[model samples]
Target: MKRPLLTRLLALAAGSLLLSACISQPGPAPRATGDLGLVIERASGSVQLIESTGQSSLARIEGLGDLSHASVVFSRDERYAYVFGRDGGLTKIDLLEQRIDKRVIQGGNSIGGAISQDGRLIAVGNYEPGGVKVFDAQSLELVADIPSTALPDGSRNSRVVGVIDAPGQRFLFALFDTAEIWIADFSQGDTPQITRFEQIGKQPYDDLLTPEGRYYIAGLFGEDGMALLDLWYPERGVQRILDGYGRGQQALPVYKMPHLEGWAIAGNKAFVPAIGQHRVLVMDTERWQQQHAIEVAGQPVFVMARPDARQIWVNFAYPDNHRVQVLDSETYEILADLEPGPGVLHMEFTPRGEQLWLSVRDANEIQVWDPYRLELIKRLPADSPSGIFFTSRAHKTGL
Candidate 1:
């Protein structure tokens, strides 16, 4: 074995080369990544597709008309996004291809819309024509047109708000000028069976369905409290909850309307923002009564609970709009007061409630935060952003 040192050295060199080649060998092809969510750029009339895992932007889709008050809902498969715009534009976009599949002008002015339980029908709430229109989700064809013409004065139109899809293929909406909530049953055909509940409340501004889509709650501007309709038991009609909640108290001048989208339910208590007041109403959901009120520095715009229902995050309208406050869900105590920059329009928690993404309009950026640690993690550049929606919304109801 010691006879030829050169032969031994040559063998060692060859072995080393073989080992290096093996170590550098390519493994299974790297799986493609970064298909995640959408960021609504209000001023630009476009949506920037972003990947949450990587925290990166993929593409900015343009030509979406009048995205000033745009909202989006995904297909059942999450392959397509239906964008409802303020200019009455309904666009079906192929998310995989990053292109618009179909577009239609459904009305002159639109606020928002909802998708059916089966994802087969899309209903839009219009302000200009004051009605809700149902369309075929797949082909974007008109199926039903239910106008809000049944007012006490026999008016032909009334501003529509809070259009939501309930269980059993029924679409429920509230008319602003008419003060009514109409339930449109589409189980039979295009001409839905309209059941109108009138005089529910005065000047219902906006409405939202509970996380489970069981209750439809509408906020009123002309009055103090809200109207609650139990979809599970429609025979009970509409019950006005928290009547004169602001009675006797001198409400501060509201710089902007308090959005009901911020209302959240944590541990059977629903936290709702008080219009023109710097506080949130704590409600016991089971009894449907006001439990307590949590005071804040400014009028709350969005009072959202963490996905895990541990903490409640509150943001303001203006003046104090630059600050965000976190409260302990159990103790109802202030946990942390954070300044996430100016113009905090909306906040969306990840599906698991680990992280929060907030849209800062004046700053033109989206800030990501760790709710548990109360620290800033990342910041994304956006143009007058409003809503931060994830593709995971497809799996859940009333997103």
Candidate 2:
């Protein structure tokens, strides 16, 4: 049902492929498995694809650099995968064949990467050039390039902080260092128009696009909390929701930079990791208020919730927690503290949320955990890895 719209919307809005372009086959597809497990080996510089249903190797990619950042987008027809590389690289990794199709330049300049929902657009945030680029989903052709730097001065253009695709791919929300935000539409290549938002509160680094796609929730650096930008009235600009909770304070390591050190959004809550205080803060999305601070280990580095919204998963970037922590969503209580990888920062669960995949930044490996039981199932090697995302269809939530 999401089809082309969701992916296209996200491709333009956020500079990330937020594609939900998975297919279930024609008349009758096989019973979907619990999850498609991927373990990125930091040392070997390879990716291992594991099927929980006990199938043979779906595919394995051999040549990749340190493997700093990774995200997968299945084609709208479920034929190929557009792989976005992070930490300065670009290319598409075939999910089924487990091979490199081609190296995509992605606008010549690059910052961070994201895929369109239908896997048709690949978005990139270019830091030095200070702009965002969106590529055609199928051809990988440059469709639009949006510059975010403000000419506050002639020579210097500030960095573009964050990008989020709008629902249905109508527009893109871009944050910049000039304290300005702009909206870019995919329907036309006409120059994008910019609106300077009055800085009412802390400038945010990373942000979440509301499900309604009307407001963008951002975590600020100097302030103790998040800010909400009202998209309902574009000219009206940002609305302050600076409710100081445990993690939004600028002193935290994650807050050290204004963008997403870690952020995730679910039904009614937003999960953020505050490395400075070693905790995960729960925010009420409706009220934009801090509901509670869920204490996590080693300065919560990243927080992600399962599709079911039943459990919240967290990992510490440093050796502080030595294990991944799982919490019950409603009660905000610890369900399990399972050790999986070293220097754990980013992770993803199978579509069913039954298994956990971790990026062992320091360990040169990825640790796979059975989330239900909080136990380690395997440790696969990943070379110089930074982040991880799952591509197999088992994780789709129909929502």
TM-score of each: 0.89, 0.76
| Residue range 4-27, candidate 2, lDDT tens digits | 987888668664333322333346
lDDT per model vs. reference: 0.86, 0.59
Residue 148, model 2, lDDT: 67
Model 2 residue 348 CA deviation (Å) reads 0.7
Of the candidates shown, which would achieve the greatest lDDT relative to the real structure? 1
Clashing pairs in 1: none
Sequence-dependent TM-score of model 2: 0.76
